[model samples]
Target: MNLLHANDRPGEYPASYYAATATEGERFAPLKGQVTADVCIIGGGYTGLSAALHCAQAGLSVVLLEAHRVGFGASGRNGGQVGSGQRLEQDALEKLAGKDAAHAMWDMGEEAKQLVRDLAAGMGLPFHAGVAHACYSDAEVAHARRYAEKLERDYGYDRIAPLPDGLIGSAAFKGGDLDMGAGHLHPLNFALGLAKAAAKAGATIYEQSEVHQITHGPRAIVQTGTGRVSCNHVILAGNGYLAGLDQKVAARVMPINNFIVATEPLGADAAGILARNVAVADTKFVVNYWRLSDDKRLLFGGGESYGYRFPDILKTVRKPMLEVYPQLRDVKIDYAWGGTLAITRNRMPCFVRTHPNVVSASGYSGHGVAMATLAGKLLAQTVQGQASGFDVLAALPQPRFPGGAALRWPLLAAAMTWYSMRDRLGI
Candidate 1:
């Protein structure tokens, strides 16, 4: 679990095209001594920084502490696809929450996509608008078509179009759902922009300031290595890094590791290879998602783990990438690394208050990029005396991953293996 101390350090940024393309400017120094604010946020990744941005813009005094540099967690290492929905599909949600609530959930997901696009465009950041779900098999492709059609017919939304297999012939991706409204971008760039915006809006962000302890009272005191922050309200937006902060939230949301590998530049012919420059993810429970970088390198991600330990990320990732694109057998994997995401058993995010003045939000599953951003805004709104939307999210029931904490991993692994086997057998 101590990834930094392992061999991943040398190859962490090994010729990563993203690292070369997006060199973040002016690293924020860590917190020193002690200070106070209206709100103190732990973790400088998406959730923390996004919360800082919204709260600061609302004219609240905010202080953010990061265990490491900004965008150092899953936010910086994700596949960069701006998918428009929850971790669960519409049909699955409808069954869980009923029709009315399910429709509301769908609207929120649409809003999430718009929120990402609006922020990036308004801030003048680079982004593309062609995210999709590429079907791997005929049955999966039919399911995609049915899903898209139902959305259009029942929900009055036509954002998703079914791409015929003929159009995607011989491509790594067969045909699936083509969503023009959804998009992709450089995730680290997006995260850094949010941090900058938050700072500009008067939020104090401290990097390399890890919160080791929390003391809740009239004012919450967040203790870091060299400093402590006392604030009227505290938000735990650390996601997987929230180790032992709150047992209640931690028990409900488990940290699962997922890895991605970036290939060398494939030149102008890359688009010809892909047919369209859209982000594509398959229908498997453990999905494989891939997208072309702005510079034309293929960034492929697939491997996942519920275990606390991280295996050889590069070696583990290569097998999955080659499954769809055996042509890439010769393609050199320049950069390979893993990120930890908080996944609830129900696959829905959890918004529970662990302390009177402190609230915790995690368990976005694989959908944290947008939900984390939205959660930050909602957390700030809740702290500002408006708590309706926050309550709506918090009301969602999340069952603990079956089996107690110790056995959760083995249990999830076994269940996931069964589903993966079913998928392979086309059952």
Candidate 2:
């Protein structure tokens, strides 16, 4: 089944809390005739929108096509945590890609955060600084502290502090590191703001324009159901929602479903759960991430499914939210939704130049909020012939799933089940 239509209707945003509170703009009409541009961007998520904005700013003609509404996918429905560094730690990156490359990647990661802060300025996005990496076990806490120290000593970055006895209020956590540099925001609003910025910069955007095939050549032709975009360059920024548009990306970047739930306004009890009002994400195979919404509702995200269809989102996520904040057991869930996000075998992003003029960036794992935004800028830079940063990301190895596209989902489900059991057994 096509994931685009499996769980949600075409051209409509999911019934998410973000969609409810987001300040949506007028929807752009879908492409119905032949169009041409300097660059054609498929998928109107953070990556595509950012790329469109940057490319337009550079005087390049840009056209962005979204299968549904802007930010309808993971960009709108995520937990909204703008995390620090690559999905893999710096030390691990050092071993995987060497010290010099790892250091370069770290600098790019820092640039990613700064780019978000710069873009969100005066955009009315609910941007906040502070994200606590909560650990369940003492050993895990120690590892976090050591990693923070390594980042300080080796990278000269010291925005992180260890919360040993838990953060300011909760006793459920053993210890964790609070990164003041990283932050959270209203993800959907952020995406919509990017769309507005891109449009204002002269990039033409079309909604409900799903691409069916890309005819690659000297000038790539991106064909939709009702129209086509012939451009010198094409960017595949669809992430998990791209599906079968490209077999190369589909093999390396597998999509998985994650669910989130929002509780009723907690009033004064919000501070009791997270004293600092910072986002908290635990160290589990299936991570439990949560933060208080602007109106004091706890937006908790956890639980995963391997299939194209999502499980009962409310029931699936509520079980884990209560596990983290049992005191909120009676708190009513106001909204619950699920989103599909791409992931690579190594959990790092997959950036590749499938063709000289065709660049595909996806598989951000769970760190898409910041990285995907940066990927767009990098994509624009690559299209402009300044590709050092994009090259670094593309050089990182992204192995395809062993079972290929047909059986990869079952294989991944089995492996994730084993890991989730380990999280429960504490082994």
Candidate 3:
């Protein structure tokens, strides 16, 4: 089944809280005829939109194509937590890519978060600062304290503090680090703002224009259902829904569905769930993350599925939300939705140049909010022959799944089953 249309309708956003409260503007028309540009971007999420804006600002003629509405995918449906570092911790990154490379990667991560903060401030969106790491055990708490100190001493960054009572109203958690620099926002509004900025910067955007094939050459021809865009460069930024685009990138990036639920306005009860206006991410292999919405509702993301079809989202997400806030047992679910996010075996983004003129970035794992935005800026620079940052990200390890794209789902499903069980057993 095609993930593009498997769960959500064509040319429309999912029935998500983000969609209901989306910033109202710019419904881009679909590609109707042949067009030519300096760059053709396939995907309209954060990566593609950011790339379009940056490329257009750099005076490159750009055309961005989206299968459905812009930000209709994970960009809009995400937990909205702007994390501070890469998917892996600094020590892990240092091990994966030498010390120098890891430091550079950390710098890039900082740049990414700042870029998002600046963009949100410019768009007049309120960015609530603080994201706490919710640890469940003494060992995990000790590790988090050490990591925070490492960030301060080794990295020379110090916005994180250790919270003894964790950040949420959950007895399951002991305590963890709270990074005041990392924060949350309305993800859909941010994406819509990016689309507006890209349009203002002269990037041609098309909705309901799914790219079916790319006839690669010096001047690549990216064909959609209705029209085609012939450009000198191609950027595959589809993320989870980027199946059949490039077999090479697809091998390392496997798509999976994650669910979230928004509860009815809790009024005074909201403060009890999250004492501070910040986001909390747990230490589970299948993470349980949550934060209070602007209207005093709890927006919780959790649970996992093994296939193209979404499981009962309200049921899947509420179970975990209640696990954290058992006081919310009788709370009514206002909205529940599922979005596809791609992951790699090592949980790092897969950045690769499939061809000399074509670059693709995806498999952000769960760190897409910051990294995906940065990937777009780097992609624009690479397209313009200034590829220092892009080269660094590309130099990082990009491992292909054992069976590439074909059998990865089944294999990963089996592995996730084992991990989820371990989580249940608290092992």
Candidate 4:
């Protein structure tokens, strides 16, 4: 099944809390006739929108095509926590790509975080301050402390502090690390702002323009449902929905479904869920993350499914939310939604030049809010013929899945089931 249409309707956003609160903006017309541009972007998520914004600012004529509405996928439906560093920890990165390269990666991550902060401030979007990493086991607590110290001593990042006892009311955790530099925001609002900024910078964005194929050549042609864009360069930023667009990318980057739910406003009792307004993510293989909405409702994300169709969202998420905060057992669920996000085996974002003029980046794991935005900037830089930073990210290992896209899902499902079972058994 096509992930793009497997769980959601065409040209419509999911019934997500984010969609309900999204800022009003222009509904870009769908691409119709033959179009030409300096850059043809084939997705309207963070990576595509950020690339459009930067490329437009650089004086490039751009046309962005989206399968559905902008931010209809994980870009808008996520938990919204803008965590720090690469998806993998610093020490893990050091092992994967030497000490110097890993340090470079850390600096890149810092830049990504700052870029989001700057963009949010300019757009008047809320960028809340901290993200607490809650640990369940004592061993996990010890590691959180060690990791905090490692960041301070080796990376010069001193924004993290350890907490012996976990979050405020949730007794599910023992202790963890709180990073002041990391935080959360309204994800859909942020995405809408990016689209608006890109359009304001002179980039033409076309909604409901589902790209089916790309005719690669000196000047590549991006063919969509009712239109085609012939451009000097093409960027594939469809993420989870990019299966048929490029097999090379699909080989390395595959889609996974994640679910989230929003609870009825807790009003005066919201502080009991979390005293400070910070977001909390626990150390689980299939992680549990949550934060308070602007109006005091709990917005929690949990569970993972490796299927084309989504499981029951409210049922899937409520169980885990209760595991974290059992007090929320009787609270009403205001909204529940699911979205597909891509992930690589290494948990690193994949950056590749499919063709000399076609660049594709995806598989951010769960760290796309900041890194995906940065990937777009780097994509634009590469298109502008200055690829120093892009080169660094692209140089990292991007191993193709053993069975390719067609068979990888089943294999992954089996492996993930084992791991999730381990998480249940607390190994």
Each candidate's lDDT (Cα)? Answer: 0.79, 0.91, 0.91, 0.92
* Each prediction's TM-score versus the true structure: 0.93, 0.98, 0.99, 0.99
What digit string (tens of lDDT, one per residue) describes model 2 on residues 287-336?
Answer: 98999899999899999999988888889998877777788888899999
Where does candidate 2 clash, by residue pair?
A: none
**Candidate 2 regions with alpha-carbon error over 4 angstroms:** 164-169
lDDT value, residue 253 of candidate 1: 86
Which regions of candidate 1 are displaced past 4 Å? 1-16, 164-174
Residues 1-427, candidate 3: write the lDDT tens digits: 8999998878888888888888796899999999999999999999999999999999999999999988988999999999998999999999999999999999999999999999999889989999988888999999998898999999999999888463477787878888998999999999999999999999999999999999989999999989999999999999999989898888888899999998889999777788899988999999998888999988899998869999988888888777778888988998999999999878988889999899999999989999999999999999999999988888887777875556778888999999999998999
Tens-place lDDT digits, model 1, residues 1-427: 4333232342133234455677564488889998999999987778888899999999889999987777777787788888777788878888887887777777777877878888888677877877777776787789888988888898887888877454432455557878887788888888888888899899998887878899999998999889999899999988876887877887898887898888888887576446677777777778888888777778889878767667888887788778777777898777877877778888888998888889878888888778888888888888898877678777778777667767887988898889878766757
Residue-level lDDT of model 4, residues 265-309, one tens digit each, is: 999989788888999888998888999999898999999899899
For all candidates, the clash counts are: 0, 0, 0, 0
List CA RMSD, all candidates. 2.4, 1.1, 1.0, 1.0
Pairs clashing within candidate 3: none
What's the distance in Å from true for residue 9, model 4?
2.0
Cand. 2 Cα-lDDT? 0.91
Q: Which pairs clash in the backbone of model 1?
A: none
